[model samples]
Target: MSREFLPGQVIVYPYLWAWQHERGETEGRKTRSTSVVVAVRGANDGLTHLALLAITTQPPEPDRIALEVSDIECRRAGLSDFKRCWIVVDEYNYDVAERSWYIEPDEPALGRFSKAFMMRIAAAFGQASRKSGRRVNRTE
Candidate 1:
């Protein structure tokens, strides 16, 4: 059975898109590549968080992958704080049919995976959205 998730909740799915950049070159050669989504964060603040697994051919193994989260993504995922907040995937479109992919799944394993994925995405979102020096007031 499928699961249900509320808005501002995180969701993680396999990455199905990739491309290349032609702006800069490394070591006098341009490199093209693709990436995958290992995790995603749901945003209560009005955005979605995505953590990408970047693959490259360098000193590290060609199969080696790195995980990275972008600031723009965090902003898009509506991340504001780092604790106790839920991460929701952004699947709302005014023109397209509204599909609910965040619902609670009947499968316990799937549910756990989804929740774990959301948590990871939330962590990434928090990292990207966290203020450098300012601390949030806890008493307020």
Candidate 2:
């Protein structure tokens, strides 16, 4: 597995959302651009754990938390096709790099967000995580 699990890196993934899983869906309905918000290697398992946030052109639902992506930031993140978009922060898809069947190791990343913008995203994610946030485990 040669995929780079770095913060801010955007990659295409079949991201199963918490709600979808709750509905007994085993896979994402579609492949979409997802941001690698966090990546930590477990000492015992030696696997890279990843937290992926979905990137969408549609605005988030009223109850969900999100951060708007600017034109420059979108371009930097290889999202120029989206004139407007937001990063959903209220929840994430969790996966182990070594065990994941959805993340393609040979695929190239779409792009990366700037450190500053990523910091903002991280902060929002942290805050949302402390609230009614949800996680969808893709490993199962």
Candidate 3:
């Protein structure tokens, strides 16, 4: 089974192990959480990029962690627009203070993809903003 995703469509990945908090968790237990898809890109093998929003028992922080997901894995997880979902890290731990919140698509990130893919994602975001009537500031 295959799925098609559009650019700028917000997808959610719930229970995704965003990170681990050593001081908060008990013993060696790791903390887990979910994330939201912020953008999608590429054609040959589209990459699903997400913005892992911060979560908290109380009020979460205003910042968000970003990640690039594989289309194959996303399909396997049945991820879709507006659908809450979760992913397990299985290896790395999440540390908010360190600002490390990304995991490799398969194993490594050495030869991820060309810079063009990033540009495509950016363009997609721009198109979405325009379609939604959101003003794009000319100045940086």
Candidate 4:
């Protein structure tokens, strides 16, 4: 079944980070709240391509690109439990939602980010991508 996805939506996912993939790991060690940055349905492939950003509680290092999540934004994204969080923009997990082995379509989205906030994220992602950001292909 095809699942509807929207940018800024928050969902639970086993997000494989680039570092883990570099170490030959194919799966994330645990499921966490992730932000859906891009979701596009391919006309020819009839598959939904997703670019998901990891929502991490760990503070970003000096060299990494990240956006700090405010308390209000966290609540809006269903992340009130976390003391703090940031959306890592330097890397993302790419997946084909229709053919995904990990995405659970039956599960409802945790919450969603406002369109305004999403615009900021999209812009940051664009910059990050241009700077040679990493991508972990979960569909592979």
Clashes of 4: 0
The local distance difference test score of each candidate is: 0.28, 0.92, 0.29, 0.93
Q: Give the C-alpha miss distance for residue 81 in model 3, angstroms.
A: 22
Name the candidate, 3 or 4, with the larger lDDT value. Answer: 4
Candidate 2 minimal-lDDT segment of 10 residues: 1-10
TM for every model, in the order presented, reads 0.22, 0.97, 0.23, 0.97
* Candidate 2 vs candidate 3, TM-score winner: 2
Model 4 misplacement above 4 A = none
lDDT of 4 by residue, 6-72 (tens): 9999999999989999999999999999999999989999889999999999999999999999898
**Which prediction has more favorable lDDT, 1 or 4?**
4
What does candidate 2's lDDT look like per residue over 4-102, in tens digits? 689999999998888988999999999999999999999998889999999988888898899999999999989999989999999999999889899
List the candidates ranked by TM-score, beginning with the highest.
4, 2, 3, 1
Residue runs of model 1 more than 4 Å from their true location after superposition: 1-3, 6-14, 18-97, 100-109, 113-120, 129-140
Candidates sorted on lDDT, descending: 4, 2, 3, 1
Which RMSD values do the candidates have, in order? 15.4, 0.8, 14.0, 0.8
Question: Can you write out model 1's per-residue Cα lDDT over 73-122, one digit (the tens) per residue?
Answer: 33334332322222222111111001323212342211122344445644
